[model samples]
Target: MVSTQLDAHEGSGQNSESEKPTHVETEHAAVTYQEKNAFQAHADESGEGQNTKMTKRRFMALVSQAFLWTGSQIPVYLFGGVPPYIYADIGGHDRWTWFVLANLLSLAAVCPFVGSLSDMFGRRYVALSGASFIVLGMIVCSTAHTMNVFIGGMVLAGVGAGINELTALAATSEMAPTAQRGKYVSILIFTIVPFCPSVLWAQLIAAHSTWRYIGLFCALWAFVGLVLTALFYFPPPRVNSEGLTRGEILKRIDFVGGFLSISGMILFMAGLQWGGYMYSWKSAHVLVPLILGAALVVLFVIWEGFFAPYPMFPRRINQAPRILTLTLIITFISGANFFSILMFWPTQAFNVYGHDPVQVGIRGIPVGFSIMAGACIVLWLLSVFRGANRSLMVISSILMTAGCGAMSVARPDNMSTLWGILVLAGLGIGGIVVPASIITTIICPDDLIATIAALTLSIRVIGGSIGYTIYYNVLVAKFTSAAIHYIGGAMVKYGNITSTEVIGEVIGLTSISLLDEIAEVPGIAGNEALYKIVIQAGQIAYAEAYKWVYYVSIAFGAVSVLASLFLGDIASYITFPKYQHDSQEFERWRGVRMSCEHSLAEIITENN
Candidate 1:
C-alpha cells in the first residue's frame, strides 16, 4: 500500500443525493492558485494496468464496516431474549424505557448530523469520528453511575453507531457491481451474525459478573474499529458529481426533518416503554407523551415531504415502491413479535421446565443460533437464485407470521409449542433481511442509497423499540389484572388472598406466570357469593393479552405481502454519477488500479 498527497488534479465521481456544490468544482473553468487540501493524504495500492486493488484500504474498510454492522441491530435483538433474562434485578420494565429512550435519542440526534458532516466533509472523517464516539460511549456506559448516566452513555453510543452503521451500506452499494448488489449486501448483512457473541458476553456478565461487562466488552470492538479506520486508506466512492463542496452541503441542509424524526421517535418510545412502570398506558402521563409523539411524527412526515430540500427520504423514492416501505415496516414489527414471550417465558419455564436462570438462558441458545442459521440459509438461497428476491420476501413474511402466530397461541403448559414458534421466528428472520436488502437496492437510485439505508435502519430500530414496549405493557397488564381477579376480593378481605403466592394457590398450583394460566384455575368459592367477577375476569383479561401478539403479526404480515407485490425492479449501475473529477484523474486512479481486478478481467476476457 502506498499513500499519495493531493496531486492537484480533477476527475469525475458519482453524485449522491446529499451533495451540494464544491469549491474546486466551481472554479474548474477558471484558473487556480494553491489547491485546498481538505482531505488527508493516504496510500492506496497501485496496479500495473486496470487491475489495481487497495488491499490494506479494502481490509480496513471491511473491518470498520463489518464491526459497526455487528453492533447495529443485534444489541437490541438480544434484548428480546435478554430483557426477560435480566429484568428481575435490573428492573426489566424501567430498563426497556431508558434503553429505548436513550438510544433513540442518540440515533435521532446523531444520524443527520453525521450524514450532513459526511456530506460536507467526507465519509472517512465522519466514520473515524463516530468510531471515537463509540469508544468513549462504551467506557462511559461501562462505568455508568446510575440509570440516567447509562442512558447518556447509550446516547453517545448511538451517535457513534449512527456513523458506523451507514458506512458499509453506502460504500458497498456504490462499489459493488450492479448485478451483484443482493449478494454484496447479503455478505455485509452477515455482520449481524457476530451479534451472537454479544449474547454470550451479556450472559457472562448477567450470570458471572455485572451487566456493565456487556458495555465494557463493546469497548474492545469499538477500539478495534477505531484502529482499523485510523490506519485505513479506502478510496472514497465518488459522491460529489456536481462538484458539491463542504460549504454548500452545510448551506442547503434541512435540519428540521432530522429534528422532528428524532424527537418523535424518542418521545414515543419513552412513553410506551414507560407504560405500566412510569405510568399506565391509559393514564395521563403515558397517554400524553404517546399522543404528542404521534403528532410529531405526522408533522415530521409533512415537513420532510413538503418543506425540506433533499429530504431524508425524497418523494421520488417513496413514489417507486409503496409496498417496499410497508415491507420494511412489517419486517420490523414481526421481527419484534417475541417481546411478550421474552418477558414471560422464563417465568413460565421456572416451574414447568424446572430450570434456573442460567439454565433458562442456556435454553435460549437454540433460539439465538436458529436466527443466525436461518439468515445464512436465506442469504445462500437468494444468492443461488437471484430472481427469487420477491418470492423470498413473501416467504420470509409468511415464516415470521407463522412463527409469531404459533407463539401467540401458546399456553404455559405448552413448552414444545413455545420453543417451536420461536425457532420458526428465527428461520423467518433469515429470509427477511436478504429480501429487504434486495428491495431497497432495486427501488432506490444509487445517489439516495446511503441516506435511505440510514433512514431504514432508524425506522426499524424505532419500530422494534416501540413494538416491544407496547407488547410488554399489554402482556404484563393483562397478567397482573388476571392475577388480581383470580385472587377474589372477598377472599382478600378475609385475609385469605394476598399476593401472587395466594393467587397461585387458588389455581391449584404453586405459581402463575401468564395471564392465560389464570383462566385454567377453578373459580374461587366454587362460584359462591360475589364470585362472578373473579372467575370470568381472569379469563377475559388473559384472553385479551393473548390476542395481541398474534393479531399484530397477522396484520403486519398482510401488509408485507402487499408490499412485496408492489415493488419495481431497476437495472444495473456501471457509469456512476460522475464526480467532478476529469478524465485525467479517472485515468490516474484507474492507472493505479490497472493491475487489479479490472485489468485482469479485461485481459482474461478480451477474446470474448
Candidate 2:
C-alpha cells in the first residue's frame, strides 16, 4: 500500500508525458490517480481532491453544518431521557404515547418530501427552513399551557429534525473525499453523544429550575444553528436537466403519496401503542386506526409504483436487489433493537432499582459511550481495509444477539451485569449504522445521495417507532400480569391486615417513584418484614417483565445476523467516481482467493 497524489500538471491535459500522474507498484495492483474528465482534473488542482488538504473555507463550512446537526438531534435523544418531566408538565402518562408518536409521525411524513425538495431547490435553503422550524417548535413547547399545544409543537420539531438530519448527512457525503466520507459521517454520531448526559442535565435543570428552561435552551441552540446556516452553509449548485420551472417542481411533489405514508404510519403506530395500554386489542379505538393505516400503506405503494410523476423514493435504485434488501433489513432490525434498549433500560433502572432521574441517567452512560465507540471502530476499520464492512455487520449482529440474550436472564440481585450487556448491545447497534450508510452511498448515483439517505433514514425511524410500540406493549403486559400474580398470590397465602386494593392500585401505576411511596404507607410502614416483602415483590415483577422485552430484542438481533450474511462484501461496491476509480472488477477477481470457509486471519493474510 502506498500514498499517491496528483497535481493539475499531471492530468489536466496541459503538459507533456513527463507530467502524467505517478503510479506505485504493489504486490497485487498499481495505485494511481484516476481522472474522469478534464473538469475534475482542474477541480483536483484547486484543492478539492482526496489527497489535498481541505481549504480553511471548506473547514468552516463543515463547522457551520455541525451546529445545525447538533440542534436537530437534540430533540431526538433528549425526550428519551426526560419523559417524566414532559408528562408531568405537559400531559399525564395517558397522553405520553401521543408525544412520542407526534414527532415520529411528522418526521416520517416529511423526510422523503424534504429530501426531494432539497434536490429540486438547494440544500442551504432547506436547511435554513429546517432550523427555523426547530426554533419555532421549541418556543411553542416552552410556552405551551395545554397538552394539545405541546403535541403540536413536537410535530413541528419533528418535521424540522427530519429535514435537517438527512440534508446534513447528504452534504457531508458530497463534500468529503470518498475515502474520508465514513470519517466525516462518523462525526454525526456525536449528535447523540449526549444521550446519557442530556438525561442528567435535564433532571438537574428541572429539579433546581424549571423544565421549561430546557426547551428554551434548545430553542436558542437552534437559533444559533439558523444563523450559522444562513451565513456559511452552501451546497454546490444543481439544475434540472429538463429546465423545470417552479410549477413543474411543485407538480413533482408527490403530496398524495407522502400523506398516505405518513398517515398510515401514525395510525398503525398509535393503534399498537394504545392496544394493550389504554384500550384492548378488540376495541374499536385500536382496530379502526390499525385497519385504516394498513389500507393506506397499500395505497402508498400503489401510488409510488404507478401514479406518481416523480416517486418520493426512486425505483431505479431498487434494481440493486441484494443491496436494497440488505440495507432495509439491517436498518429495520437494528432500529428495533436500538430503540427498545434506549427507551426501556432506563425504565428498568428507575423501577427495579429505585433510582432517581440522575441515577438512571448515570447508569446509561456505559451504553451511550459504547455506541459512539462502536461507530468509531467501524470508521477505523473502513479506513484501514478501504471497504470490507460485511464482516463488521456480522460481528455487530452477533454481539447484539448475545447481549440481548444475556439481558433476558438478568436478575434484581445481579442487575449490575446489565452494564456489560448494554455495552455489547450499544456497540452492535452503533456499528450497524455505518455499513448500511456506506453501502447506500456507494450503490446509488451521486445525484440521488440525499434522496437515498432520507429513504434509508425514514425506514429506520419507522422501524424504531414500530419497535417502541411493540416493546411498550410487551412491558405493560408482562409487568401487569407478573405484578398481579406475585402480589395476589402473596395476599392470598398471607392474608395480612394490609389492603389488597392498595397493592393493586399501586401496581396499576407505572411510575417507579410510586413503588418507593407505596412501601412507606401507614399500614406497612410499621412492619419492616411486610414492607420488605412488598418491595421485593415489586422488584421481581418489574425485572421479570423487562427480561421478556430483552428476549424479544434477542430474536430481532439473531435475524439481523442471518440477514447480514447476504449483504455481500462492501469492498466490491466502493467506488470513488469523482476520482474515476472503481474497484468492482478487481474485487470480483480477488474474491476467488478469499473464500468464506477460511479463517478471517487467513483471508486477511491472503489479501495482503
TM-score of each: 0.70, 0.81
Which residue segments of model 1 deviate by more than 4 Å?
A: 1-61, 73-95, 112-114, 169-188, 191-194, 197-200, 233-241, 274-283, 319-321, 335-358, 376-390, 409-414, 485-548, 562-608
Candidate 2 backbone collisions, by pair: none
Best TM-score goes to which candidate? 2
TM-score of 2: 0.81
What is each predicted model's overall lDDT from 0 to 1? 0.52, 0.64
Task: Score candidate 1 by lDDT.
Answer: 0.52
Query: lDDT by residue for model 1 over 290-325, one digit each (tens)?
Result: 888888999998997787766656565553555456
Per-residue alpha-carbon lDDT of model 2 for 285-332, expressed as tens digits? 999999999999999999988887677776765646786788788888
lDDT of 2: 0.64
- Please give the TM-score that candidate 1 achieves against the real structure: 0.70
RMSD per model, one decimal: 10.1, 8.5
